[model samples]
Target: MAGAAPILETRDLTIRFGGHVAVDGVSCAFERGTLTAIVGPNGAGKTTYFNLISGQLRASAGAVLLKGAPITRLAAPARARLGLGRAFQLTNLFPNLNVLENVRLAVQARAGTGLDFLSMAARRRDLAARAEACLARVRLAERAHASAAALSHGDQRKLEVAILLALEPDIFMFDEPTAGMSVDEVPVILDLIEAIKREGDKTVLLVEHKMDVVRRLADRVIVLHNGALVADGEPAAVVASPIVQEAYLGIRTAP
Candidate 1:
């Protein structure tokens, strides 16, 4: 729908550390159930912007709003409780725990169940069933009992995704989701991400370096250069922008 109020928005969202302004007055919104990609060269403050919105980092100045309500004061866990889910650039997995245990624990926490793992482990059979469904969605059900450490790197990434799915958030944020996967593994992870968009209908914010992934999955693209929003438009137009081309995508001169 055109001109719909954003599901999430930042009002002059700014951040700084000493003299370095990491993100400078970035004001943008993600409409309901849209997948928006944040793309730029290293040091463009893409992840920092993500952190600010998701509550992993405090804004030096400005506000983060969810559905026209301010959430800048909310902490990371609080945001998660309010339907915000984040998957990090680095895999967040409990290596000593089995795949099922990892996801089940997230389900327990997301449910606001008490954190007495030792005492609650046996009684949370329902949580296990929920976790199984999450793993199945990510195609990790066959390795349900496999120790996270024993799984291949690609599977570990999938497990992390399963954990996020278990949280059942309304908004999903991903930071460099394919950063360390093998070439063969990239397509599988991308497929899962695409599936998440189609199946869950959740609002998505992604920080990704892969052009192919961004082009394929993003409904819109927001490009950053020097910690500021340089372009915001459809993928084809943004990628074709001379400003984006020169600053980040590299200008091409005809031979």
Candidate 2:
């Protein structure tokens, strides 16, 4: 009788560091099957807001809700267990492990299979199959045996996405998914993200600075400035708003 609750919601979420408020009382709701881009200039708290929601930083005030349930107090791993997945701006990886091993670990974690090296051997075939499938999706299957640390920046980014895929989260949070990638390597990641949006069952939140990428992928856009939400609307409207144009896009109208 009632409509389904939003996949994620932040209610006046605030976080202060020392004397400054980094993310100031921002409230927004994200629905299923929509991609919302969070855009702002450097130091606008976009990533900090993401850290709070993903449980990397504690919120000084307010709450984070997943499917209408409060998860503000949960730690990062706990939140991940609750279906909140985050791919960082930096490539977070097991540098010592080979690419396949890194992804297999995520698969094992998601399947509730503890990381017992000896026991893992018994389940290697199945877990590796699943992990390889994820890698294939991101075009990293050929690098399965290579050390994750040795991959190029672009490949590392792809491996991180593969790991995220292995976890099968309901909400995908990507922080600048294409930060330092090459011109040639950028499209693979973008195509993967586009495919995710096309799935139409997952909720996606992206913090990106590239206006073109935002325009192409975002269903909605919300702007943040000085840790506070400044503008929110359809992508074109939000990007063209005077406040966003001045604060984020660095565009100033002539008098």
| TM-score against truth, every candidate | 0.91, 0.96
Q: Which candidate number has the best TM-score?
A: 2
In order, the Cα lDDT scores of the candidates are 0.87, 0.92
Candidate 2 has what TM-score?
0.96
lDDT of 2 by residue, 1-255 (tens): 149988899999999889999999999999999999999999999999999999999899999999999999999999998888889888899999999999998898888777565664536698899999999999999999999999999999999899988998999999998899899878888899999899999989999989999999999999999999999999999998899989997889665
What clash pairs does model 1 have?
none
Candidate 1 local lDDT, residue 239: 81
Worst 10 residues of 1 by lDDT: 114-123
Root-mean-square deviation of every model = 2.3, 1.7
